[model samples]
Target: MSCSCSSSTNTQNELHASIMQKINNHPCYSQDAHQHYARIHVAVAPACNIQCNYCNRKYDCSNESRPGVTSYKLSPEEAVKKVLHVGGLIQQLSVVGIAGPGDGLANPKQTFETFSLLKKYAPDIKLCLSTNGLMIHKHIDEIAKYNIEHVTVTLNSVDETGEIGSKIYPWVFYEHKKHRGVEGAKLLLEKQLLGIQMLVERGILVKVNSVLIPGVNDEHLPFVARKVKELGVFIQNVMPIISKPEYGTKFGLDGVPSATHKQLMKAQEACDVNVKLMRHCRQCRADAVGLLGEDRSDEFFKESFADKSFEELAHHYDLNQRMKTHENIETWRRALRAANGKINQEEATNKDELSSNGNTMLVAVTTRGNGLINDHFGSAKEFLIYEAGDKAIKFIMHRKVENSYCMGKENCNGTYPIEEIKNALSDCHLLLTQKIGDCPQKELESIHLTCDESFADEPIEISVLKGVRKHFFTAS
Candidate 1:
């Protein structure tokens, strides 16, 4: 029983200037939006000690813990009724993270009893947490006695002098042996830079999620953004290593970094400093919640743990009673083949030959600016088509604007001409644009030389391409 925060330097600099103006008006860091989607992670502590080969505590290790992944383990009165049923169906619940299947201070009694029942029932909820500072210097007084205001620390390398943080976090259990490589990444980067300099000298706002990993720590992300901006760490989320070949893990088994928009704006201009690089991170889970890319986890699993009706939990998981039809593309391909099963028969026959060839698949879904598409016929609207083979096509563009062109840049008016996105892929010979650029993939392969071999060069994990097109082409 210890959680208190109110030093009130004008209410912690107006809550760190309204969370750095919502992380510079997020769309996952301003691609003006194309799905960096978030909606509170909801698996409380399954278990994790430390072993990051690109994580696999069975699939809940927002930091560590792996095995068949399904630790609901709920109760702080079932997580404050799933955070007021996901804060009345989300607009900005902002953040309430634990970041686990494990390690919210290594599940400190279900992470401080779910942040003391969301500060005694959702006290204007906004408490983000993520850890790997191996039990964050013994729960910095239960995360400043629960005034917990956003802390992410997955410091891939503060000192394990590379080789991908010594082949992904070699081992760290501390005082109980199991300390390998750069002696357990220099004792977990010296207790995560002494819990990020005691949560930025107790102002309580720090972010540093570095996972980069191309040739391991892409030259150590500007030395991990100049050592978490000399421990003041306002933000630095350099993520991109979610390597999963069914969790064998050598860090997402090479070849995921297509890294364009001029290589993530030249690694955010070579991490010049003054931290802040979170570009709308969907490296989420550990009870994630809405308003970055919007998931609202089935309206917080039907108003906090099912009273029923997402068509009665999709007819009790027979799943696909038109997936309760709303965010369609067959309701995001039947909720990504029921949360990761199968759906990529060349993106379900390029959405059935663009709906048997009437040809209209325009999705623009913007969050804004440095989130990258870099103009390719950009008035963005078409919306439906999915049959990636009989002449190749997979269009799902949706951005008429609903908040995140880095949070409405003076109503973002600009984009569309690589010739109007190759004249909307000129009645498709092949085109599957889920955010592409390298100068619009050499101007859409010089106008359709099979539009970069029918997409999926990357960024199509909408639940492992709907579980590899529902267990190999819509259940045969």
Candidate 2:
């Protein structure tokens, strides 16, 4: 009963009809769908039963951007209204869900209440819920009752001996009893697996989110991936653990280092499961708004729209306009896919372009996907990593950015983590994007990296091949 994926990447063309329909516009589930769709999370759940070594929930932490952190926690009533207001403004907004400042299932009353109201009001927007999986077995019937088609379970480890889980999660509270050590770990694992199976049986799409913690569960995730895939799980997202010292979590305080881009890719490559690896995750905040990696929660506070009714905000939701916008996006995407197909024919020729006596280096590309260098450097959330040289031009993997260089006019102060971006691309020789401001261009140049915008609308592989030759093959 496993999906028929020939490779690790999931393509709309290869997806089954049922799976495709569920992920067509869900940003979290589909790699391609994310480029054109938007999603939002309402922080209605504020209780958790299990304590992880890497978590320290910060309610009203406006500066730090990560899961278990939110600027405000809204009641079920306020949450439904926020959805209506945001859905009207962002025509591309397709999914609304509750991902926590705490575990959603732990606060079942608030979680289901939010679902009931959103179901009653904004039926067109798909419903998503993320939880710890400790309570899912207890409430699968109610979840089915609400018709929640999408669910995310955070299953960090799959070690049956509970050794790996003991390192990641310290304790668990179930059925009014607190358990610690290996016992707690085993109980949590059993519940998570059972709940995931129940969800699959009910025909619900399940996405397993596992944090890649170094020395803790990094070596154990391959087993986790295989187990979930065997259990009819839809997809598996392997995310890097964020353990900043300021977050005050156990790992952060104990000086456990955060996973680097290279380490994450290595773990992902090591897994090699048929289940798709999600490379676009930004490790979004619990109450995140707007597209991936971009948080605009501050823009739509309760005080900002306290007087607006659901009907008043709902009036602005334009189905016709959304349809038109999506149509335009689809047209360009189709062209992009056609162009990228050239890789099959052109790749054979490029493999030995400079094989005998040429230098090889890594190059980073910024694109919104259409086989074109169309995304601006400051706005790109990911850099498509590729290996290029006289020998060949091949895509290796993608690297995700924690933040974008540009937010907007009022917030664009030219000091948006330029150094961080530089470090992320340090090994690469060149960066290709639609455009970049002089400030970043100069910063990147200081690291001996060249930035080019000349191939703004050109096909990615062809442009990359040419750019590599022009810099390394030609006489200066």
Candidate 3:
């Protein structure tokens, strides 16, 4: 009995190690890789087969970053040309994906052709496919044929009754026809379930993207997480819906509000224990061309790279150099883990003292992700929140700031979304950031939230522990 259990444990460990190795440099799939690697999505598939109330495919909408919005569409040949050109320029370019201004599987020919061209030209770069999963079951073999290993399926509901799904997806075009209402929802759900299972069966890493639609399917996402975990999903990204009316979606036009930072937290908190939750998702554009948070699509629009041939562009790819850079990144990541472990150990040592009298508080931090208080206030797109005091300093959840306060002073002139940011962090007791301007700082304090800048660039866990000890435990 002991030997059997030991063998099973060893198998699980080996499987986990293999998965980790594959995702070690995949930006969207791994939190550790997110800061170091880059991913690009080509908008070659211009036709979508399903309709979601929240999605409005807009072309040349460069101001916003969201799924189904692209500056320009590319052909299979143009996509490969751009990939080679960008891969040459961006050493960290790890995964080439087709996330769409439309559905990936819907335009199967263009989707697979791009992957095929990349395989023939730049085999070292990885391939990824993101789709609605309505037709994913049918394309699993094709997905595997091109050596594509990473797949993302946006699955919002697992309610067998399709009651929850109906509110989100009004229709799904499958089998040469459009199915509507509950029937469409049921069909879409069935396909997503089967496709996810098949993708797992073939040993492809699967990431499920479920949009947090506040009133519609927000309460039902914990169940979605549980179902996806059962389907052997490698990771899950619970992205908040971007329903601003200017984007021109049905939900937006009807005035359906987007999910607040708190509502998103409530949903993710319930699901993260069951499956790894991706809080760092930028909900990237179809033509997004850089690191997760940055967009560089404009630089590579067709004409700029039209003259660069495969060999000329491939020469600069240099996978060996990329691997070396990734090794250095891993070294940094390992050191970060060790430092965090030490902080946690020290916090544990003082756990009894901390619990004796300190007032527990929720502290928010700004980070660029190597476990440091690095990002600045008014510029942070997201905040790393933590529960510090009494118990161990624990990461609660990351809250997304809908709009940045300001990028530069010239851009700030009464336009920094300071009010929005303040409302997002209203419940927090303290905000830890690299720096903050006096105006926003004073406004934040009005809500009883204090800003601390003394621990800038320090290890986040260490800073959180000291802050809690100083403010809540020791007398001023």
Candidate 4:
């Protein structure tokens, strides 16, 4: 069923109450609350079902301050811990979100588990989920059941582009199989729009995040805005495309430059005619912490790990060493917490320099959550892209390769084409992974891609900042 909004019988106060009750404190949905309140995203959903050419989910989503990155992924229990811990520290933290290092609904078990736990621990905090909207139809009932106040669904294109109207997404996994090209894009768009319609019918606030890929979807977004508005989306967030050659997205590799601020504003202005435009978005990460105006994810990570080294905590979450996907890390965490209390007590005396600014270099990190550089280069299915400037580093996108060479049983007989690797990461200046073989390493180097194995034990922000300074700035 499509959204059927009515206003004839509704009073102005009734309308205001409905809107405020849902978005009064949601920073992303409400512009007024952005400065006054804080929101934290727990990266509990590490799996994704769709593949966007523009994303490499290997780095924290705080890229140069854009969103779609997280320092690490967490189990639902750990997510609850981080929320409670950060909530105690940041009094203004009014919202807890599961936004993905991947699609939130794609990992419903993890997303709902985290949400259920939050109800028990931090009931007052608003619950939010950000999904690609492929699985939204299947999960809409659960979303309403859980009282998820806000949902952000990314709608890249609605006007059909022949085979695949939306060049933004390449494939989607639905009904347990993969659908590619136009069919996949069509299926995704159908579900996304239908899901938004369902949410609106449920009286849930919906925000549409349309990535303005100029020359690709820029001309197509106004159509999207009108369609989504008809479906009852409360606001439309027209975000700029951060495409760069070094980041290696299909669009980036094809030499698609990021949309300028002027172009972005223009797109928002055009879309605003149909829907309420969200101009105050920061594009926060899936595991973002702190207020909407100020991100404290790095600071929170440092404080959380003050007692234990990243390497020590890595043992619990290393996908290579673990038998169960979500093995109980509580015992391991308890031991670490005992050790950290004393260490953090001493370290708390000195201020941590977890600033976000640094030289603006796009760096990709290989990780399997747990907030550490743990994934090997060849086996990595996702690469989290970040933009690191002198003062701060923020996550931007997640690049999902169809298949990693090392994931198959084949040896390095050049099975992974050098061109494919080059195309995937032509825009990135640095690649951070726990390990890389000589062949892939050399192939990447041939394309002017620098590799860093030294960041294996560091937090994402620290590693990227240090690497950017040492690798790019020191030479300058």
Residue 196 of model 2, lDDT score: 98
lDDT of 1 at 207: 77
Query: Which sequence of candidate numbers ranks them by lDDT, best first?
Result: 3, 2, 4, 1
**Candidate 4 residues 120-228, lDDT tens each?**
6566788988988888899988898889979989888885543535466677889999988888888887888789888999888898899988788888788988998
Model 3 agreement with the true structure over 356-466: per-residue lDDT tens digits = 555557888987765688888968978877767744575555676667777677666766677777887888998999999898899898999989999999878878878
- RMSD for each of the candidates: 19.4, 5.3, 3.5, 15.7
Better of 2 and 3 by lDDT: 3
Q: Candidate 3 — what's its lDDT?
A: 0.84
RMSD of 3: 3.5
Of models 3 and 4, which has the larger TM-score? 3
lDDT of 2 by residue, 1-476 (tens): 24556353355454577778888888888766666678899999989999999999887787767889898889998998888888878777889979998999999999999999988878788899998899899999989999899999999988888888888888999999998989999999999999999999998999989999988888888888899889988888888889988889999999998998788877876665446566667677888888764578878899755578777766766556766876777787677667655431222223355333546667799987545788999888679877676545765567776677887788777568777788899888989899999988999999999899998978787778778777776752
lDDT of 1 by residue, 41-65 (tens): 5567666777787765553233322
Best by lDDT: 3
- Model 3: per-residue Cα lDDT at residue 74: 93
> What are the lDDT figures for the candidates, one per model?
0.51, 0.81, 0.84, 0.71
Q: Candidate 3 — which pairs collide?
A: none
Q: In candidate 2, which residue ranges exceed 4 Å CA deviation?
A: 1-15, 342-362, 367-418, 436-450, 457-476
Q: Could you estimate the TM-score for every candidate?
A: 0.32, 0.84, 0.90, 0.62
Q: What does the lDDT come to for candidate 4? A: 0.71
| Residue 76 error, candidate 1, Å | 16
Instruction: Judging by lDDT, tell me the better candidate of 1 and 3.
Output: 3
